[model samples]
Target: MMELGPKPRRRTPTVWVGPVPIGSDHPVVVQSMTNTDTADAEATAAQVIELARAGSEVVRITVNREEAAAAVPRIVERVRAAGYATPLVGDFHYNGHVLLTRYPECARALDKYRINPGNVGARQKDRNFAQIIEVALKYEKPVRIGVNWGSLDQDLLTELMDANARRPDPRSAREVLLEAMVESALRSARFAEELGMPHDRIILSAKVSEVQDLIAVYRTLAARCDYPLHLGLTEAGMGMKGIVASTAGLAVLLQEGIGDTIRISLTPTPGGDRAEEVRVAQQILQSLGLRTFLPQVSSCPGCGRTTSTFFQEMARDVQAYIQRRLPEWRRRYPGVETLKVAVMGCVVNGPGESRHADIGISLPGTFEEPTAPVFIDGEKYTTLRGDDIVPRFLQILEDYVARRFGRDGDGKRAAAPAGREAAAPTRRGEEDAGGVAAGSAARSEAGRPGRPAAGTPAGSAGGRAAGT
Candidate 1:
């Protein structure tokens, strides 16, 4: 198979947020900010734990006021006592310098401090920025020089605007803003290094709401510095629009190998799930083949043949089941997140696709017999009908998990399961008893003994199978 997707990651200076490493050959990190009021230490700490459980490597909480800053140490203590070692980041804007100075405990408690250079004010911009850096240097903590387009440094923006006007054809306001964003981040990083902070202790981010603008700013920053870049599309609106926009922006940069750590800034609706942001980030990374956090449910978009919503309902249930059981499963089955389960509908491409999954089920469609075939390791294992289809398939799935990953009598996990190629047995030109067949071409391409042929279904060639 040919190499695809992201180019090799650009080299960047490594920075550690607690024990987790960012940049320079390490896996891309997923992070998120808590929406809870930081002044309420207990609530903030609880949400932090929740985000950590949802796979956020680092959790950020706003430290905008003295009360919030004062609560930091308590929040940190609670999270640590609860057995989560995930790093907590302090997101500071206008008053960070003062809060970090007056509340030394807050400075000590946080693993990292994020300073937005844009809102640090024009008259005391340098002084305020320097104060924040001094505290970070004193604590020996990593600092992210975050520059937001909305709260950009007015002084730098004004200067860039002036310079643009001198050109024969003046640049647009957007171009000037982009330049200012990059300039603000680089200048802040350089200043921190000058103040005796090591380059590796610094991370950088320049966020803009527009997808194209966000990409442009990060690409410029990546070219100019080796600092680890934090990727985000700030102020992306709520619901599907936010998810799509954030994914589009982050995916483009990630594929080009530009980001180190990422957070999806989605505006949650009233009483919405905060952990949804973390899931979105995980899905984006997993979809791009960058990381795996949970077992994936591959389901198909129902067409005319699938008249009933049985497959759709089954897909949702399977996904929910995986999510609910994932935490326990992780402790019990070390690599279960890599398991792929397909729940395909109809006979058109169902069996061919089902054979590619580790475990899969193909349910009957309209005008067809009401039976479902379950395949394990690319071979037809059993068939089911009536009300037991879901339960039977789930049982087989659980059994497969236990057999493949359950611990031995000695309390240690069993040997790692074989790869798909080894598990898939070659049938030559024979069809299974269920009227389902695995193509000879698929078997041959899988490096088994068979002849090559064309017209294989989408998920049949030893790849991710279609589900639902």
Candidate 2:
């Protein structure tokens, strides 16, 4: 596994959510919760399917009341019948113990149960928590011991605060809260283990609204225990602020290899797509090189040198095209998600960026040539000009996909091209000499005197001479 930062992964016991693995050596799982009313089985089921289609490995729905709990089996049935085996999780709070007990079917239907350690009860904390664990044991399902900073166990928090007060140097309230959050999760997991739940059957989460607190608590928890940690920043507010904060927090921990599974708790805009949360999670993983869900297109931001919006327009169109074709590609070409395409605005960095991609195009800008060069595997193949640029470039992209990922007789995709060495310009030049532009300079030797190679520092080479 790739280590993104200094800290090594906190190796933990593995847990399975249906056929999907969580914990040691597994791909970090992406999960999201449905915002629909859980008691409305149809709405919940539809949202679950939409989330699954959008790449959520696990889908959670709130099961607060008896009505919601009762609807679990039907929701599961509807989702499963629609052809997705995505594991459905129940998010239970204060009334979880009672609902799981009174509605045995609900307990049996869910693949996993998420219990909040804080809201169970103050006086009967142990009893209520244990009751939920027992139901998990009875149903043979794994449990996620989720402890939020906002609803932290008051008893535990008070005890920690009192102990701090007696110290010569009391810790900050945020520090105390962090400690309490970690303690609540570890203690709850231990409680479940004591009640006959195996270590591998327990997952833990300690979420806080503050990004720093969320990262600190999880770091502490990862050091203390080997349970699979579910990472998230709780109650992240609406819009870009929420996306940025959640991404920053999750990225910190994830880069440190601290989380096993993750959820982005974004408050969606009114009537907006719920699938946006799932897409954000996928994007984070992809950007980190941890996972790939679709083909990646590297496009440059337009600038002063690029007088026309053609390159930016082409980039957006290409991205949309890839997204639309991804589903069919996945079914037909198993490894196509790894494909890299670049659409660069101006000649400066365009060719170098194009050279690095599986397929690329360098569009002309300003007073330069009107031609656009198409690149395949680090070599310039052809120059496109005028109204044919978009459609022809698209055609080249389609042919490249076919040549690289066409299916065999058994209907499985052919093996991917070996490596960068396999895509050496010499081989491609020999294969398609007619298409190769005569005297086209290779990427390594293309740099002009006193100028860095195109795309070397990324968008920096934008306004330079074409093919330099």
Candidate 3:
């Protein structure tokens, strides 16, 4: 474990969710949950093993009741036994602390517990908070206080309704919803403090299904408090839309320095791996420069300028190839987070985009110089045509992965050398970890709903929700 400075006071992060530090200037975290039934030890352990291999910094699984809690120790042990120490977080809903207290073994097994602030019943709120805190305190595990508007406290909702009885505006509902989450979270943390827990022992969030609402509440909380925030778009759907929506919202908050950790929740597909959720989240954070993962791929969206379908196919093929061979990559490259490969559709933008990548291929049309341009370490090394693309591209990437990233056995940081900003990573939505100098400006240009494409893309932090 790397030794860090003595933890600070108020701004100090509550708990380190994983092995890595993830608060108060620490790199943003990327995490996901297991799709395997928590009750099924063999199936769940198998899923955890796969997730660990996929570069998931943290793995969460629902521990809805006692049966699920009983499975925690076995699953967690299986993860460690598999030789990967990916931090496990027990996702608890109602009566969570009861399970933790009854099965103290769970407290000893997992690294963190994600508690939904909105669901714990008011009548049992204090008891629930204390029970969970007791478990966390016993193990020194960090807690993520997650709040979703969809599952808001019934009592708080009623109180909010009563408070707005005189001049009720619909906006009041949103405001109350956001405020209620923050207030409930603060209340829970206060209990932790009263119970003698340290300040850096927790993370907080007010996640929502709506992007605007999620961004709004988080921004509000960050401005007022200093707790490390966990960002997510709860129940974010699947496919490109789910990934984009979650990224868009999270990117906005992350750029502004609001989120300490994040997850991109995708709808689980039948027979589909849920761990991919963590990978996609990692890619988003890495692309935005918030976290690191498998080498960053700067593949292009093919257009009329594209020479052949080869470039597009090459991109998919290389990714698949890497996926199949990750064990070897990790074994060989030691500390390489990703392979830093780029596959551009055309030479026009490809060449420039390829510069930041470790290995790159820029497909070209009939050219004066070469049929295709390939760059290694930013130098035009060779030209390949026709069927030569895939093999040559893979060769360059492998060389870059080996030389820059080193073999998997050697301990080295494959991340690019840091620049001036290591002094202080900017607040959310300002600059992504990608160091792309251009973020919201590019997003503004990408086009918004009714807004002009003449403007830049809406930031990942989120614009003013969908309304204002």
Candidate 4:
């Protein structure tokens, strides 16, 4: 990836969720919550591993009932036994104090405890909140005092509202509500500190669903607290709306350096992939130039000048190619995630954009040539044509990845020089740690998501029952 200038981060005290660090000094963390019933440890642990493999640095599961609490140890055990270091966070509400106390092993198994002050028992709110804090203190685990709009503490809102009502110039009800959300998190955090929880052991989040409200609430919270913050637009719906709303809301706060970690709350369809949330969160960070998790494909939306069918098909094929190769590529190529590949549909801006990417392919536009020009390091390496375009291009891509990012014979990683072509490198079979040859690897991958039409074509969990 080209250097997209990084924004100055907001400074905060660091909080660790297992081995991952959350603070301005650390890269913004990507996290996702599971929709699986926590009582089913096997299913939940499987999804946890899936989310972690998909790039969730931390995975949170709802621990709403005794069964769920009882399964915590097993879930943690399974996740660790599978060789994933991804931190597991237990989301608690209502009977959290009881669950944490009765199930000491569960409390100890979790990397962190998420407390929703809104539903921690209104009558015994402070007492119950203190109990969980004590458990966290005992286990030396971090706590996220996560506040959501739907679950803002009514007592705090009413208190703030009544106080505002008495003032000569009262604030709007919405303003008071947002204020209450912030207060709920901050007040709980302060009370936890008073109860012996270290200041650094606490994380704060005041989340609202609306993009504008989320921005306003977080801007205020960021100003008032020095604790690391978990950022998200709670209940961001499903599909395109969810993705856009989350990206919009998060991008703003992230650009301002407000969030320490992020989770995308997308309602997955039944039997849908829960790992989608993790991928989205990673993309948000990658898109903002804050972090790089996978190679990004830049493809133009087909215009009148482009052959819609062929062009669109190539774009989809290219993206699918990158995704399929990611697992192996990541293991073999240390910095391969920073690779940028562009699949342009036409000549107008295609070559220009292709030249800017680490590797790119400019497919001929309508009435142009029958060939696709492939670029590597800003130079035209070759022009691909015939039915072999996809395979050939993928071959070039894998070779570049192996040569530029893969380790050499001595096992030290090699890098392509900036602004110039690099010396001829050992072929993929020679240098690859896995010893997989470039030709065979590309052929296998291209065969899986093979492109048809030689010419052209086209192509989180959160919320109230528990804390997000």
Candidate 5:
């Protein structure tokens, strides 16, 4: 049988961006770029903070002009003031060398510099590239040699095309293009190292718009060098189109374990939320089992057996409750982000599915009894009924989270509340009118696998119930 799961992450030298490190040794990093104007320090800083809170480990802002370059220090200062140490990367183009030289503070404030090798200038290409590398070396900051298909070096492409034409069995134009993208990234990386940047202080990216092209480019690029490649499908359109394209391309390579850091280049609609990109990047990583940033609610789509909308409303409320409580839970319950929940509307798969979650609620179907069974640790904990079902289930969820994940003031295990011991399993028709069945029992906290100890944060795979 074929082995399954994400390939072993490709080994590479680690590069520290402020306090965060990127390499095969660390978790795959999620990053985003602010669409806000970098010259507007207040707006940029606000968006950076939002992105960081939304789980962007690294945030980049364009530093194209003098004003933008001047604002870099203020932006970094404001973000730090907001209590976020999320590393900032300055995106530079043609004038990067001059701007970095003129605004020493900007260069010093930024955690990393991202320069497109194709746009550094035609005649002064080598000189400009070296200038940015020199500043990075001086400040001890890492550099990302980002190569985009739209901005690919024409000189290099022409050279490769001409060389390919001489071969007796030349590859297709698309094949040559992919090779050029990989070559541009690898060659620039080698040059940066020669210009004094250490191997661990450099990152590489070669992005293309189309899904297949991106996969082809990154696969070749990842094989040729171990510089911790940054992955993305550039110009991935807008709305669902962008999300689908980006996910398709990034997922394929990530499953093969080729990328170290990732960004979803989504084109948001006017007035759309800028933080959506951060969320999408997070979902991709989470879905691939690479990282966990929030509580995951597993819900089934409504079917004919579930005619009423009560289950629908319950699922939404449950998700909203988790979202609202996550901030407090993350601090108080070190491993709560890994919590798995199920909200099933019908009895067909409800109980079985609910039994598989850390905490779950299986609601009644049409013509079935109105009681909703709440399961904890694969056992029926209680039954909720009538108009009180939603609220009762939510309370049980809150109690379970606190009892299982909460820590004490002295950083010790928080004992279950008085009178909170596991009740004996309940029988039919035994539920009280107030909504909860008295005899149902919750799981005992002791000896539970994946229970987060006092001070340790939950591992990527912990905080979930067994058999899930």
Candidate 6:
């Protein structure tokens, strides 16, 4: 037999915002909002630059009125002057068409514009969408249609309510809500198509406060359209609950290749910088191996065996330590994300879970032979005992990061590591995945080896893991 070459490799991005790609084949990009008064150019530009430094690749500003639109010129000029080249998004609610028309410079300055279809106009939302499309065409910008559950068009809600009266199911309210969002997006996108707007010029967000609702609506929308989807669970509470719920919801979607971009909207702590939400977005993505604005630290969930308050305190203390010393680490190493630092409570699956990690400390527990081993690059380098383990673990992490991102003056981004080559898999192998075809590509990212999630699992690869 003749020798055959490796299977042809191809990768597809999970989401596209106009020409901007996100998720999967593309690097995860972070976005944040400007807290400045929209009309104040200097203040808004400063905030935008600050947010970009915090890892916000895209910055959205509220354009509630024409004054905000008028401020765009100065905002654009100031942002450029600061040398922070983050893309700006205009948020339009009631009269997007007016600002988009009268403020060509502002629209042009904005890399993308956001429109809330429910609040765009009183009637014939399509006409309003058309008006906005003209501005996008004139400026050659992309648009994101953001639809919130609380702000669904009253007419659609009423109609959906009438349908729910006959269906009589627990999921009726949510089904109707999802129907409205998908319908709204599809309708608006149809208008954009009619006016000859390229599909790349459109992105859509269907955000609800509840995670389940957000997932359901977005799931339905993704199945139906090829447009880039922006994922968010809007107003998702504060503190731990917000983090848990948002992560849970997005984790489910991202595993299935449903999300293009994600935002974890968190309520800012009192007297704290609102940029925390943006940081959360970067952290979650980094943890999942989705994005790389920060270092990845893996700490095992504490259990009975070898459990210690010391481990708990250390995990948190180490996190803070990394953040404080990150600038120095960046000075030393150029691409810190390629280095992984693991802190495990015990052995169990700790080593396996973090096997690919660059460095890890497997605490003395059931899995570790006395004089617990500390692993670097998949092999044990030393046996750590006594009270020296924690500090040593932290030190190893710092050295690893320093070796990667660099220790240059004032801490700047160094060159990224050599690219990892990925080839798309051949076929789906889901055990209980429905509607999967013979040659459909399987999602090989998760550890399950093509198992669908619980509850809902269908993906573009044509099958789903059930239950999130």
- Name the candidate that leads on TM-score: 5
lDDT of 2 by residue, 160-234 (tens): 999999999999988998899889998888889989998889999988898988888888998899899999888
Report the C-alpha lDDT of model 4 over 1-468, residue by residue, as the tens digit.
674565588899767676556787667777889888999999999888777656667789999999999999999888777656567899998999999999999999998999999999879999999999989989989999999889888888889999999999999999999999988888898899889899989999888899999999999998898999999988999989999999999998888878988999999988898878877887888788877677789989888898557877877877877766765675577667788999999899999999999999999888887888888888887777777677667767766888888677342222322323222333332211211111110111122232212211101111100011
| Each candidate: RMSD | 12.4, 13.6, 13.3, 10.8, 9.7, 13.1
Per-residue lDDT of candidate 3, residues 1-468 (tens digit): 973432222254434554444575445555667877898887888787666555455678888878888988898777666555556789888878788889888778887888886666468887787778887887878887787778877787787667776654545666877878777777777777898777777778887888898888888888777788878988899788898889889877766667766778899777776766866776676676644455556788777766567677878887776654454554445445545778887767888877677667777733324476777667776666655557655665555566665634243323332221211111432111121111111222223233324322212132210000
Q: Over 4 Å off in model 1, which ranges?
A: 1-3, 407-468
Q: What lDDT score goes with residue 27 in model 2?
A: 64
Selected candidate, larger lDDT, 3 vs 5: 5
Say which prediction, candidate 1 or candidate 3, comes out ahead on TM-score: 1
Q: Please give the TM-score that candidate 5 achieves against the real structure.
A: 0.87
lDDT of each: 0.78, 0.77, 0.66, 0.78, 0.79, 0.65
Provide the global lDDT of candidate 1 against the true structure: 0.78
**Judged by lDDT, which candidate is best?**
5
Off by over 4 Å in 2: 1-8, 409-468
Worst 10 residues of 3 by lDDT: 459-468
| TM-score computed on alpha carbons, candidate 2 | 0.86
Q: Candidate 5's C-alpha lDDT?
A: 0.79
Runs with alpha carbons beyond 4 Å of true place in candidate 5: 2-4, 408-468
TM-score of candidate 4 against the unseen true structure = 0.86
Q: Model 2 misses residue 105 by how many Å?
A: 1.0
lDDT of 5 at 41: 99
